[model samples]
Target: MTGQTPSHSERVDWLRLARTRQVGPVTFNKLIQRFGNAADALDALPDLARKGGRSNALRIVSREQAEQEIEATHDAGARLQIASEPDYPGLLATLDPPPPVITIRGPLVPDDHACCAIVGSRNASAIGLRFARDMAASLGRAEIVIVSGLARGIDGAAHAGALETGTIAVLAGGIDHIYPPEHADLYGDIGESGLLVTESAIGTSPTARDFPRRNRLISGLALGTVVIEAALRSGSLITARFAAEQGREVMAAPGSPLDPRAKGSNRLIRDGAALVEDANDVLDILHQAKRPATAEPPAEPYDPADAETGDGTDHDRLQSLLSPSPVPIDELVRQSGLPPGLVHAILLELELAGRANVLPGGNVQQAWPEDQD
Candidate 1:
């Protein structure tokens, strides 16, 4: 509708819209697809949120905040990599709502260089640590890049072993912040020889909520994920789950059945993940892994030409079909007997309104006003 802006200005607008209130990656993509540009989407959020049944004012990150975040990124010796950039890792782009923006420090390892994630419990055993380190070193020697959360236990050990070769530490906090406090030196080393990555913007601190999201990135950036040691309840399991959902190979090293830290890995092996004892095992599995061709995301969130004015009727149908449980969007389209474009429009409205949670695999889980998390 107007003259095109320069790429730098375009990036700024993209960051601003991505940092906006109620605009998660999926929502952000949909908004861009529907409205045609970030500036327009940013202009439209207030009305969108109001229609979603929000009472309080929307809290979009301001231009000042976005600018400050970019400045902090530069100050920390990192740079922002947008999803649309050729420099962005290809494997990561496979996720449904691939990170819209990522801050990277150190060398940008392309997804073509095989990457394997080695993660497990933070409170790891000495033997577990040793095994993780050794496995990482061997993988590195084989020219495979290691990826892990920069947490304690297996993650740190993995990086330590692979530091000389190459590794990536995906952080849960801002690109500038380090969690657990003790890994400061390790963080520095990785930033020098390896890479540090995060979806968090500058000045943000890590929270319990951030780790699961971080774990997803760790798995996503790799061709396969290797769980060294974890309890039945651990973030490593979550990463493995993400690997499975993303159609990547999920591998786990066997541990003593008696050790609680081994339960998760053993379970993974039992549940169909490849059992990897050494780097060779992982290499073999990865070699055999089909490694599906990454699908291109829709250029438009939906075909706007097919859009119809939706109201209470469409909303009611969606509500009846949705529950606390997450279901694929395709199923909703099928069951509701509604046009896919109309379903997307209604869902977009509900998402901005805070009545829905868009999960991975194009599934959506509804949130009742009474039980909003």
Candidate 2:
């Protein structure tokens, strides 16, 4: 969400680079920063992967494959929005590394629009469901766009309440592949009235790893995230965590102490998340909020001299300091007594070699054999 819309051929190169194996959001942004464009980034991948000690060349998506994906998106009545495009959501552009490209169906909200996400247990209680629905409706009446994953209980009810106003459904699968088949009708309704979004290709199905990515976007798209009836370990809490990390407001509805479904939300309130009883509480918080600034690309151009193609000496020195336990990248720089750029370069190579895991919140851990699976 920083640059102008890419032309047709440029868009295909973006897709090809984005779909290349091992190129996550962070890597994609770094490649763009290093090379200045997707086509050049695609050309650099094999050499970069090899420098990291990969035995085989990196597997990059072919131009034909990328073109087919673009065509399929159009066939499904959706359009692709690159992060640099003006049409990408403004709030989402604030993320350190937003989705490089997203497939969107329906129209996006106006640039000045304020969105609040409502997320919670899929097995929520009756009272919890009612509160989510009513809260979403009240906020919608105030012209706030509601955002959520199209799940069973709270998400479904929230979407139903805000359908007439505006809403956005961020999917874990392809925009066309509706999960929880029971919500097919709701999915259709949103497609026509609200926006449907996903970072996956047209034929990709939801997997265990995809939901967290979807949750990140749920929080990234909004100004704040509200949780209701979440358990101690649930996706709703994950969404709220992302909200907080992204400098967005995090709020949770109070629930009974005895209910297992209420444990997470109650804990959030205990841990200093704003306790809310209704949409008014959310509005009060939003009234006092300052919108986040858009994230900008790296200022300096790529310097080959700075991105040193390390020899085994540097790689081995870094490897000796790493363990299976997750540690901050800053700590790695301090411990290894190496320049930050060299540390990052080596770490990226280690990641492409399947020897390291670059986690959210700027953490890294050595990847185990099972982790590769």
Candidate 3:
């Protein structure tokens, strides 16, 4: 939880701050903590970026643009939801800062309802598709919601099987931007019955980079992720990795070793993920593990005193110690011999300047020129 349910004006400010360039999920949290609210953070961006070594002012998303997004979302018959709302999924709400805002179509289920992600090869084998379909159908019958990236093959099959029940399609692009063009009918079906969720803004088409972020939401919304058939390089594995990092169950449907499509799932099994033969196996694990008691998102936001003011020399020294390789922030504090608060402040500024990357688990890395591009 981040703060109380936002008022109409607060929601607009939130959208603007989030849509601002170089303001990622992690930075969004840091900005809120440092500035006490999005409006203040929005006002501070120019000064902060200049202090962080930017020659020109940072491009903050405008209030007019934010307002247009709101209107367009309304026109689409969808609603824009902030993470602090009660309808926002708990599994996502508990993530650090969570997604600041998401555009959603259809109804949102309560956090207590079970959500399991089924993902695999977009070029799935017939047999693999059948298994995924059956598994999703069974899980749907048990009142579980299926979450998947609405790609072709296994994902489409899973949605089809669970159509009678409820499913959530997390698009790689905007909630209104349907990728793979062929799934337009399926997309409509979901909006009418299931839910369509996306962090991307209206009218934004997805690129290669968008899928990984989309994969994270697939796993984040679910209690577990199920891999039906994935090659060694399949994107489904990325979703499983996110699930594991999020402290959720990772389940895989075993496939024969001879099949290349099975390699990822098989390797996952060897690495200690649960082997799920069908939806029954998944339900059993859910029953046994049970959902952890989720803490409500904070009603009172944390405002860090002076978390953005830092010495320039000390900040440079800290930047010199970091590379693209992930290093713990605590280690940077120790090695740079800078005060922890100063280090945090410097990192926050660098992030807003697009000069840093904060990995999960309290790690930080330098964003190389290529990464910035």
Best by lDDT: 2
Best by TM-score: 2
Tell me the TM-score of each prediction against the true structure.
0.89, 0.93, 0.91
Cα deviation of 153, candidate 3, in Å: 2.0
Q: Which stretches of candidate 1 lie above 4 Å from their native place? A: 1-6, 298-300, 303-308, 313-327, 330-339, 366-373
**Which portions of model 2 miss their true places by more than 4 Å?**
110-112, 296-303, 316-326, 366-373
Give the alpha carbon lDDT tens digit for every residue of 5-83 in model 2.
Answer: 6898899999998876577777777778878899998888877777767786667899999999989999999988888
lDDT of 1 by residue, 1-373 (tens): 1123337766787898777645667887777767877888888888876665667677777778778878889988999987766767778776777888888999747565888899998999999999999999999999989999988899999999999889999999888798768999999999988899998887788776568779889989888999988899989999999999888999999999999999999999999989988999999988887765665656546554543466666776787788887899999999998888888777776776677766656888875453242
lDDT of 1: 0.82
lDDT of 2: 0.85
lDDT of 3 by residue, 41-139 (tens): 899888777676666667788889999999999999898888756677778886655788888998756364788899999989999999989999999
The TM-score obtained by model 3 is: 0.91
Clash number by candidate, in order: 1, 1, 2
Model 3: CA > 4 A from native = 108-112, 292-309, 324-331, 368-373
